[model samples]
Target: MSDPHYDREAEKYESPIPSREHILSFIQEKPRSKRQLFDLLALADEQKKAFERRLRAMVRDKQLSCNKSGVYRPFSNRGLLTGTVIANPKGFGFVALDKGGKDLRLTSQQMKLVFHGDKIRVRLLNKKLDAEIVEVLETVKTLVGRLHLDGKKPYVVVDDRRIKHNIEITELIDGCLDNQVVVVEMLSSPTIDSDAKGKISSIIGNYLDEGVEVDSAIYRHQIPAVFSEKALKESAQLPTKVIPKDKKNRIDITKLELITIDGEDSRDFDDAVYAEPTKNGWKLLVAIADVSHYVKEGSELDSESHERGNSVYFPHRVVPMLPEAISNGLCSLNPKVERLSMVCEMYIDPLGELLDYKFYSAVMLSHARLTYTQVNEMLEDKKSPLRMTFSNVTDNIDFLYGLYKTLRISRQKRGVMDFDRIESQILFDNKGKIKDIVASSRNDAHRLIEECMLMANQAAAKFLQKNNEDFLYRSHPKPTAEKVELTQKFLTAIGLTLEGGIEPESRNFAKVLKQAKGRDDENIIKTVVLRTMKQATYTPVNEGHFGLAFEDYAHFTSPIRRYPDLLVHRAIKRVLNTTSREPSGKMIEFGTHLSMTERRADDASRDVEQWLKCEYMRDKVGENFHGVISGVAGFGLFVELSEVYVEGLVSIRDLKDDYFIFDDVHHQLKGQRGGKIYRLGDMIKVKVASVNLDDRKIDFIPDFG
Candidate 1:
């Protein structure tokens, strides 16, 4: 094919042979070398350089690739894939394909071209699925880390382990001292020969200072910590108490002896519940804070809440989605206060099946603010002092407990997968240091409130579906085949099996858990089973939640904290008072954004907890403690201390008189020579070796003479 745009090229350049389009079309069928192309085009010596420059530009733009043998070929769309880079601290990385299949592995050399969380295109190498970076679509622009000074050279060590490279500090602000946590703005991206360069944008504080972990996590995860001035102004203007106009056309349930049951430390109460014995079975009323009533759509408060998505609860503090003026003041369902609410009233038969439900706006008064401990004591013992103290709500507690038992029967019959994992509470001293870490027990009171909230959420989803309204559903898809296979292998190694062959329901998992109960390795079995399930997320497509075993489920209970619940509140109101329907496109956008924010909050909180745990163990080095093998990896074993509820790693090298080999299927390390095995769930004594605050890691070794 001759140069079709040769005349046009000649008008732009003095020595022009063919346009880029012409050259590409000619080489599209078969890749050609530069010399071959020069001979084919019959180009003069002077024009060769210009043509070569074009080829290099095309290659830079990923339009073409030059093989090692010097052949230029156009990229086939099938040969390239787009994905987000998931980097490891070890310098190797993987690309999670957008369309969802097995991830493509990237070598350390290739990982140097892109940072973690960057979206990029990769070209498949072979059947083994190794990939090469083709082009970066997006790059991480900032990082959060601690500043380090090596003589005159200043650099930043990123807090996120997934980011491997140490960013060179090109500029530092005044008063930004070494070893202090700071946020860095990327000046240049990393390359094969050099590290990424950045400037200290803002100093968080001293790395070891009290409450610095929370601040660092906020910046590290890019979570918005401060509300906008407009949002604050709007919140400050909100009324402290519910006005009479706010109760217009809404049911007045202020006289009902409804009560809130939460943890002892909980401050922002969003839900109040009441139950009464009825002829059919029971009548239950769940009143949630009407946050939507005050935070109108398109208002600054609403915008700020949407951005936050949900409250981020830390061990010592909380980053609320809404301002305190709304979340803890006007919208909070505090005791003896008139508060606007969105109520879900349900009628259930003796069989525990939901018979009828209705949703409406209401003015509710919480008669008492009860803690879980108080409620449990009142329900567990008739002569309990709490019963005498809260005599007014004694009948209400009995009614709620009866309803909860019936609901438990229904939940068990439906095969709800329950993982009775022991949760730990990190109690802090007055000096803001960890005083003690203890197991937080869950009682019947907790179950009662959870069941009530679940019913209300279900009713909300059912209501929206019946009205043909588009909204976000809490969706939990089935596990991937790969994860399921690994889990099955682990189960089989332990003389157990997941009942479902390929596509199993929640009941199958519940059955496996039931069989594993009372066994010594029950926690191990439950942990492996839990790992096989997919994470639940908000989506407009309504895939249904596999974990909760719900056909229809939406968050309708905590509008004061969760954005999806707020959105659910708005959707319900739209159906009740107006005929307007939110577009499906907008719903999808909201789902994705809210899901991301939820994950961000989880990551930030986890980071803070890990840092605190590391700090707590800093002074405990050389002390021996017994622990259970929580995890087994090729390099080490992760053990959780039975006494303190802290986790640390015992490196394979630390094992005595054995060359350990990792057994992935059995979740253990086997000795090649000594025949000693360190398996998951095995209790072993270990001595604390060291703690790294920067990495939030603790090292332990076997305590042996």
Candidate 2:
């Protein structure tokens, strides 16, 4: 018999918990594709019985579908697809194809000849868009995974859950111990079927090594740790520095009290913002390091950066977009360096209204390199010896702070919703252990920097707007009816009320949030309300950003790490400096693609980050921690621990004695017997139970008082 777990979900889709009937029928019913068989049997076993009877009846009635081959399929007779497999541990997965709406559902066993993360050919058993994966054309010969010895056999547990099964280590090449993640090479492939066999090729490192994140990020991102020969050859020839006379002119370095403010450990500084109170209002100079000036479009360096898409910054290390020579040296806006930059000069008034904004190309000298901690301390009147280091900007910092206040007021008036949540920064030890988790707050300096970046991005949006041009503008669609309705119900259950529904837009939501300020569940409210809004994405068709309440917005800062920003920088330069140059229609289209690609890279990066963070928190298992309910699910509640800022699943199964039902409308998990409710923004205590680093799942036992 097939594995019990496998057979359960593979059955007909009749169980409250999906079972294996559908998968088996799909595999057994050769005439019909898996999805078709599943959907057919899923309809009613009574009518689906007797294959000839069901087919004859369906054909006679013309209520069902089939092909001329008499082999029923989803799309066509074969219902096959070539795509990438995205796996979840639930034994089912989705296949992402290159074509539009290309995702199809496949079961664990139906994943024919493909391994997780492998590009493969799949055949749909049924005419369903989501069918079981029927084939995998190519398996990743080299993979990164954890080594776990089960009895006599050792298995490389894949970090990527998309791979349905653990790869057995036919040979432990380096005396690799259990629970250590290692690299593997595929030694066997299913000749006529889907399963892939592989061996542990090399021991990468211990699971929680300090450098593991960088290694994982590089592999997951497909980033080459070393530069290619072609890329290296190109970088070697590149000018180390712009010639003394090559610059347009010696731009004022001491005149403007420009500063770079970022995280404490930041190595690459991409932007500097300086704003001085002007006669009419304020003159804000947003200078972004000119990366395009060196990484010329279509060059080998450009091609490399494009392939990398963006720099991946892990806690311990960074996978740079360009080689270190460019990212950390020439292109970095390090203080005292005369780096090329594209500046957005904006004049604004006390009312937070922009009088005018213009994009300009220039070379800039960063007067000081500051960190958020330093700026925040100065703002809070904490003792700082380095206060003298930024003497020139001491008074200007005051001015910048005042401008951000005005911008905040202005932004509020414009209905922008600022979802300010406490983000946790994980500190690491030299050995790659999580030293401590620190709660990060948005301080005056952060706001000042953020306001400046927003201004530049909004200006980019307006630039194209005024030109009446079709360009890639980052947009977020309004919430859906179902999500909005669900959110409304949740708000009412928590005794919170909204004046208007989802139609009220960002300002309205901001007002509600402002009203909920300092409340215990404020973060929870913000998170869920955000869930109701559409995710922001790059598109030529502008729908505007509902979250920022911006009719126009584009990323015009941080070109060092983000491709979209570089593209936006190019567009801005073309508009500001190049009088005869026009952005080709093709160029705009490419930007859109790059923007989408960049978004995917960001998502992947975030997933990897979240996974590693969870892994780091594993050592603290069984320890009780304070957390807030971040989300509500049918099976459990999501608790984001206050101390670590790491989120874990608090399974309802372990929440006291009462049977719990998901009160989704309340955004909480409630006990049916006691009427105990755990809402989205509720404060709760939890003890960590199981930390499945393999699943990136942290199971918490909720403290139900």
Candidate 3:
């Protein structure tokens, strides 16, 4: 008496069903309705219930999903987007969209299913761009962390704060111990329901071990520490000295009395300079190491150099972009050695304007290697020991300083913004622990080299533009309108005005800085204006450099350490030969990649420096020091100690007298009950309360007592 269709469906539910693989293969070939899937799999009448259960299980596993019309398809085909997950330290995460749309935000619950840097497929849930993780496509395979043992249970707390989950350890490599820093390799990636599993690969060292801080930073940031065998082999094959054939079409400028000026610790000399007074004004020759001559394009060495983007300079060491064989051996501008170079011969008029410039390959011998301190002494005192030591080059040094002054005037007239912020240099003792932190002084020697480099960069940009070649330009965009408005409000609070209207040029900002030069708040004002500007990046497009106020600029020096400069050398070569080059699209992609690598290097360097600073301050807890308020937040003020240049938080709760309100517009924190205010650049005394090495954080309290 029941319907015949019911009888048939019931009969089908009694038959044996196909395996998941068989069903999935059928669905993958082509999407189908449930009825069609049953027919396609050729299931018996008795298999209907089993088939339905299997379909539901697949949907639950995110292998398949059903449409509104009740048609089944692969989950990836159901309008899910793929992206890399960027997790926050507070548990939330965002999917950086691959197709260049707005990022999709994931809730804490959704973020639990995947780790930071995991590539996943996501589906938007609402108009707010909130997304649900459909599937994890790829997981971060390696991590650096501290090993911990809970009784007999072992695990790793990853150094990257964004990776919220602790990795359970299944095994340990030789020499690994609890509380030691180790690198772990993921044995199993996290799923929707379970945590990740890993095995310790190698032990870096103990938490408080000497040099371990720098090692931890290196691993934490995933900076490449060693070159590949192929790259090293290529470097080894490079000639120990420049061959005679290499100089065949190169100009001979070995008698120009060129001198290399660099830091006392510098080993790789990338550039040398010489200047002389000409009939017009001056002739300057900047000879840069011809790295392109040794590291040919598309070679293994070139590939590695491009991947590095630029050399990373840390307090105690450098991660050079090229191998030592090339960077410090064959290509370094060593004194009295004939080396190949790419010279930028520039002519400047009496008014500091660039009259003309020509780029050519040449051979040169460096007369001497000079340090900044030595050169400064020679300039300040005629009878200085350095002056007597390098007597032959004293006349040339004087002329270079004269040219630098002219260039400085020109730079000021062009409205270039210069922020005179104090940079700290960490000095290490014999045991490699920090001896002291001192302010890095910049004198005329540094400025002379900088202006020379700027001129060469501008010349390169001009030459490329004239030839209509595709190349990477160093471009700095102006500040956003919101930031500009905020800056204006803050400046007005300080009784200062920003000239040139709402769309003021960089010169307007320069004027404001000039007005505050001798004021007690000069550093604070400069810091604020600097924060309101955008970071410079490499681009194929010819946007002007806003900070430098240059209409066109390109990095053409230091090819030994920067990949962009090497590429620039290649581009210049092609232009000189009148050869057709690659299209602009390719250069644009390369520019974007190089810019990211540059930032990667910077982040790694900064991470190491922070860790070192934290270690240096660990012993100073309970001590009092003078500090300046460097940053203000809703929760606290960040005070940078004047003695050690280390910054720590002064929590709002410690203010004690009243509830404080953060003023975003004026960049200050005001107390409601006490009517007290703490603003940026306020000099105050503070006592260090505690240091947390685990979080690399320090806490401070005002010395009100």
Candidate 4:
């Protein structure tokens, strides 16, 4: 009564199908057509539909792939490579090679099937360096974005410009409005033919609300913003003050006239210093808050602290690694408070060479909490108000100043590279809008405290090394050959040369920097040299610090914020207790993770600052300003405004007069017909043409008239 084919298909849909393993095993041996596979398995007509469903599932899982000939095989049999997709705002992407080769470029059409940060398997197209998305192993599951409305439909646009797709919202949370910043939970992964679906998880706030810029950055970077319930409970139950028993084994240094010097806005005072001149040289005592005593290993608080790795400092707020109860209350070296500390007592010669040092737990009281400005005033005039107020520690402050001078000379002799870069600080209004971006000044007081901390850190590193204790060291490797060559070419283009052989030492770079000082392109030269240097990272293997020119260097201060410092403290304590245990293998993994978290925080902070800068410039469109060419690229020249410290791109299209060609070797963009060149460090006038808040970009055009 029914058609034979329809009846057969219906019967196949109702029958039992072969196991996925069997199907995979058969296909993995050799590529097989769908009909051939069905026949090989001896599947009945009634099982064909179920077999097809399983095949589709396998393909979706990336375990199987279908060829143009309708043949299927295990993905492993194909010569596809696995990598993570880094999407770009321009609709294209790159597959970061998993095995450390050149990245495979992907066209916009291929990028449409995947999102940024997706783990994917890609196949090279025709033996070229370009790849096509073959399968997506994983998709971005959560995102922070702004909510949008399209007629009757609502969607979320991810703030990360690299992701070019809008997530269609299936459900909206209460209180969510159009254009509000919200966190979204993806409901389904994207496929080649469909977009990702999501539901609003939490509404952050209005787009332009106070603190929303920082909040958005926090969420976008996946920074842990809140302490766990267990950590909070532990913090709440902790003792607010140090007790008598807590000071049992500690050497009492409460009478040493120690003082804490910090920035005006610093909250958590971590280290206090006291120095006195000796017949031989000087005696320096550096006391740091013993945060490990309160937050023990394997505790809930410690777990959370380790996960956070380090505190993140934004403009007006901090995402602390430890609870405030510990970081700011119990462990802070507040003035007049008796706190537990780990003290580094060092004897240095007049030449700033360390003769000897020892570490011990101690009870110390900071006599005064002085700011850099106050200390600078006191140093310049002994009759300053702050000097009179804290007269008890005036002699110690003066001795510290003398010791700092000695250390400065020693550092110069040691060839440490000190780049005189101007750092900017944002002044925020009550509503958190940027009032001004001013250059942060460095004074004598800042240098004094820095030298003191450096001596202490060096002492800690040497102590751990001599005792053969396991510890994390801050290591900076020399520049790579490729980078060195590029730097040399750039230097030559600027009418300079890098001395000290092929592998130039830090002193050579220092010499070049000194030579470039007061020059018209001083900042540019410094920036280029800095770019040639490699980034410093924490490692268990000591490779020495190239920038500091120290044979051994580790971060031993600020344990309240940095995890590496905490580990150093713990290791020192273990050595003090005469224990001989090596650090666990897990410590290496933790070091790597901590380094990544540090970079993540830096990136997140920069993102927030850029967003704020864009908001600040929104109202200044069409205003003229003087700027320096900070970057040169094929598309445009990046100019940093001198008045606001805001950087914007001057697109080549807006150059107007001539076509520009990028010169990568010289880091310049030159015009074809006009012969005009835009190079790094060249000062020029520009007008703010546009500000795109959605993309967090500012655009500028040359003001030739």
Candidate 5:
């Protein structure tokens, strides 16, 4: 083919070769080696040097790509793509494309060359978009798993069930035994002919050892659970109590009846609340620990805090972002002690609309430390004896309760999402054995504090946004079109209607949940509706929070446990002072890191909870319980026990008498011959058949007999 821009190239260079456009066109038809391209283009020997230079430039510019064998091809989407591999234990995977679109499926055979979370280049195999791994760009260095000896040779079953390959143990450390949880360092990557090989780096513990679940989860999720030497030293150097200098140049709100309300077992108090009736409506003050004041920017302590991002709360343990001295001591708003804090004071009308707000550094003394239950008891009954005990703050609590009701009304009017999801808390006996898993219910007191924090966070966002300053905002985007369509189809299949036409608001979701109330499949409808929403994230750019129905929002509470709140405190300080230095770091990158850390903490917590739940079910085999089908997959139906809240899979193979076909859109399985159907949210009786501690899996079977 002739060069399309030959005249342009000729005018630009005396020794011009074929234009880039012409070269790309040629390679688009078929990849050509440098030698073949030189022969086909009929370039003179001297011109070959210039032609090679042109090819290099084209490759550099991403117009073309050169393979290892000197083969050049067009770098177009249809031919090749780069993405992260999302692996499945069922022996298949998908590529999450860098440029967002439908994920390309990788068959079991094609997945052998890569590990989960590996970034790789893939070539399109056919029209169905089946992809073959072209090159692995990155590999996960280490994995946490249980070691097992198959007769003589040893192998590891990865803790993350997504990775299906049993890695061969090339070297095992001394004292490591069979069925022990260990961390393995990869020695060789997987290939079509052989499995991955690794050496044991460290032994966590025996698979069933007490507290082994927490240890395994910490390692598996790569959560930084230990404090660094420098950070600890920094913490030690700080004074044990609030000093006079720390309170200097701060507004004194010590006389105000500010009280901290939290859970019964809570120790690290991050915020305190005070409220009074104002002429407009009400005056509310939310005082957060001034962590940025102590943990200076760029300090070792700050670095440690930023690395942890947020505290990880397990069943009985907490991986705190700050050291105990800061998180549980000086920064904590303990009762009857002077504490330095960053305060957000807001004035609102009777209708609960925020009218005006002010941010300032303050020195405050908490009058009382209250629990949610105590607050609820005091507010619910007029003659409650506890009211007299906390008389110093009961009036203040009443004022706060009034403000909470107003804010709740405002929130409802604003169309905020109210998901009535029940969270399970695992109870352990004195010896740390599983006792029971109970639902943690939220009451008005919880909502009061939540509303208070929401208002403060919203004020902080508005304060920074109005100043035109760059800061991280808690962003929750609207759901994608694809998810909405799927949810619509599911709702339609169930004879339900999502109110909003296409782009629904939070109110629309709330309406659906209300519609599903008391129905047999209410839980299923709630789960599906919840799944349609997008995950909230932290970003420098302000995208309004969809779930909270907030036009402006940032996390300004819990600086003691969250790094972003610390950043917000610093930003507020900078805006409040002309000489104060702004917080350091690229805001965009910081947001991304914090978001990932949040997810990491959640995953680690979930891992520990799953292990505990598996252990809880180990002794219940053969015991039948009533459950609701929570999830439907081609392989099985996941049932959540009614009272215990434990989930187990009822495999399709155990569903006797017929071959079942999975209906993905309807979320059900239909028997091909008998026409028997099992669906998500259908109530049924199931017996605990087996439990796999290593995999953290519980298996159940239908107990019709």
Candidate 6:
């Protein structure tokens, strides 16, 4: 019964069963009468009932259903079944089925009839899990955002970043000019490539004004900026602040030496930290905003948060996860006020290895709120007054700093691939217009807190793993063999070598990165090493994290912005309570959904940021900047500008001196006659020739004289 050999699955097809063996033999068998065959292989009384009961339950739950009817019956009530469109980036789409063979794949061309997120029907053509798009039932019409011209044709660049294509805009609302953003309605009448015709309905304005802030807020998170009358009414009716009556075993901890360290402009203070040297080691406390407590499950507020997924922060604006009533007020861990929190109590020894940890529902006091800039300044300056403010806690501060350094070193020794990726921030004026682009350097304060959060996350994962609990883990698998080989070649070309032999551990990559410090190509090497690694994703499987070099890891902090952390909180609470009931199948399902949602949110955020940055640079078409060759593609070479820290393409035509042919596998372009090759990480200067704000792309011409 435990092992289902070939014969068992054969029997399953004869008898109606759910999830038969996904093999050829089971699918290749001859037809049988549906009811009679099932009736023939029936088991003894209770066992028969149990099997039928499970099958019925699965069917009733809409998780499974019968597929094809037999030849014993002439009219086999089966043609094709279909549902919503799910897709992948490589341009393949799936049509959900119910006559229930398998989810069908709709080729990119077939999907040209119905865009992603459209509900459509499909016909079976090849096999189970394969089909052709038959019809589209519904298309999502109205999209929110700006109108930008593509070449000479204009396109409605929707605020929803999940939309794979930019719909062309035909009708325009007056008072909106080129590069002047506006939200538009997509006319139901189909247009270019399965997309709908669209027209500008409203102006969101230029990127810098107050109205633009609201627009940025909506554009970043895809959340409606203007609240519905009903929702706003509910907010207006609710109490402004938490009264003392809401207190549970309340004791004020607002006067303790707890401090918040974040960016200078961060308004939503979700976490506050405090630490001091203990007897055996050090005592570290991370008090995070108790958002889950305030936003109860199944409430309107809860539904809103779930839909938004998380707060979206653009370069000059923010879209909050929770409304101002909660995120910026009662639940915020601000100084001089009592705020409830869930705390992680950590113990670490002198060697910087985190020894043990526990989580608790606690209230913490913060004496001073600190910013990263201020902390960095104080650490560098001997006579800074901020050090004196921590006079009573000076030893604690020193110990914590020393511990952070030790942990960082320990992390490196364990082969943790330290990726110091540079991010560019566009400075905005009071009017919200982009004034300049600046690259923000990662400092010790940022790394210190990152290390702290990592410790907590790792400890949480270890706890769940050791307890044999059903939990979603943050995992990054080993890179593909092909990717590793490519990485080796790139590193060798860039004057760096992966140290621990041909087959090197992640630690070898880390060592190369460490040694590349102060080199001109440091960023290039770091970027290459990063690209060679696998992406971190969440799963129920404990695959381990390759980048952090941990056997197990999870996201336990940042409950405010991450749903997985909230689930972790619930899991920890369940364990603490030691209840009779454990997490059901729904718990795992929810974890999967949340993980997927988190990734979706990330993609949307990144897409919007790119669009905004590209839009900001659109007006400065002729500007020049020194740059490096970030990538070489078939079409052209990608130049990363040093001044703006933005990347654009230099089309192959621009390389006029020599006819270049793309050397595909090696990631370079060869001058066919001259034998001069342009490759990845090659430094050069470029002049921005054109910008397509709608496509969020810029064109460059290589200044090769």
Residue pairs with backbone atoms closer than 3 Å in model 4 (clashes): 11-46, 12-46
Q: Tell me the number of clashing residue pairs for each predicted model.
A: 0, 32, 9, 2, 0, 5
Error of 2 at 467 (Å): 4.1
Regions more than 4 Å wrong, model 4: 1-74, 77-84, 94-107, 120-138
What is the model-wide C-alpha lDDT for candidate 5? 0.89
For residues 1-705, what per-residue lDDT tens digits would candidate 2 score against the true structure?
A: 233454544474443222234333454545565246546545444434444454434433333334423454322325466887776667677788856485877655454345667776655555576454344567676877778886677777676766556675677775778878778788875422323568776776787766675576556545556779888788787777655664764354435778899988888899888888887878888888888777777888777777666776666667778887887888888887677887888999889987799877777888889888888888877356666767777876777888989898889899877788777777777776777778877888888899889898899889866765434687787878788778777777777776565576777778778877888778778888878887677666678888888888877788888776777776666665544244357655666557655665675567666776777777788788998888888888888887778888987778867888876677666678988877776788988888876667888896654
lDDT of 4 by residue, 18-133 (tens): 66666777787899999998778787787788788788788778788765345787775378789999888899989997776889888886787788878988877545687766
lDDT of 4 at 561: 94
Sliding window of 10 residues with minimal summed lDDT for model 3: 1-10
Give the runs in model 6 whose Cα sits over 4 Å from its true position. 1-111, 119-131, 145-255, 389-394, 465-471, 495-505
Local accuracy by lDDT, each model: 0.89, 0.72, 0.86, 0.88, 0.89, 0.68
Q: Backbone clash tally for model 6?
A: 5
The best candidate by lDDT is 1
Worst 10 residues of 2 by lDDT: 15-24
User: Per-residue lDDT of 1-705 in model 1, one digit per residue for the tens?
Assistant: 677787898898877767888888868978999999898888899888888888877876778876535678886557679999999878899999988899999888778778899999888776788887778888888888989986578999898888888899989999988799999998887866689999999988998888888988887788888999999999998889988887899999999999999999888999999999899999999999999998999998888889989999899999999888888889888999999999999999888888999999999999999999999888878999888888888889999999999999888888888888877889999999999989877899999999999999999999998887878898999888888888888888888888787788888888888889999999888898898999889998879888888899999999999999998998899899977485578888899899999999998988899889999999999999999999999999999999999999999889967999999989999999989999999999999999998888999999975
Model 5 agreement with the true structure over 548-657: per-residue lDDT tens digits: 98889999999999899998888898888854444346997899899999999998998888889999999999999999999999998999998898999999999996
lDDT of 3 by residue, 34-91 (tens): 8997777676777788778878778768788654345676777468899999898888
TM-score against native, each model: 0.89, 0.83, 0.89, 0.90, 0.86, 0.77
Query: What lDDT does model 2 reach?
Result: 0.72
> What alpha-carbon RMSD in Å does predicted model 2 have with respect to the real structure?
8.5
Candidate 6 residue lDDT tens string, 119-188: 7655565555566544566766555655676457777655443355666787877786776667766676
- Residue pairs of candidate 3 with colliding backbone atoms: 11-45, 11-46, 12-45, 12-46, 12-47, 12-48, 13-46, 14-46, 15-46
Instruction: TM-score for candidate 3, please give it.
Output: 0.89
Per-residue error for 513 in candidate 6, Å, reads 2.1
- What's the lDDT for candidate 4? 0.88
In angstroms, the error of model 2 at 532 is: 1.7
* TM-score-superior candidate, 4 or 5: 4
The residue pairs that clash in candidate 6, if any, are 208-431, 208-432, 208-433, 253-365, 254-365
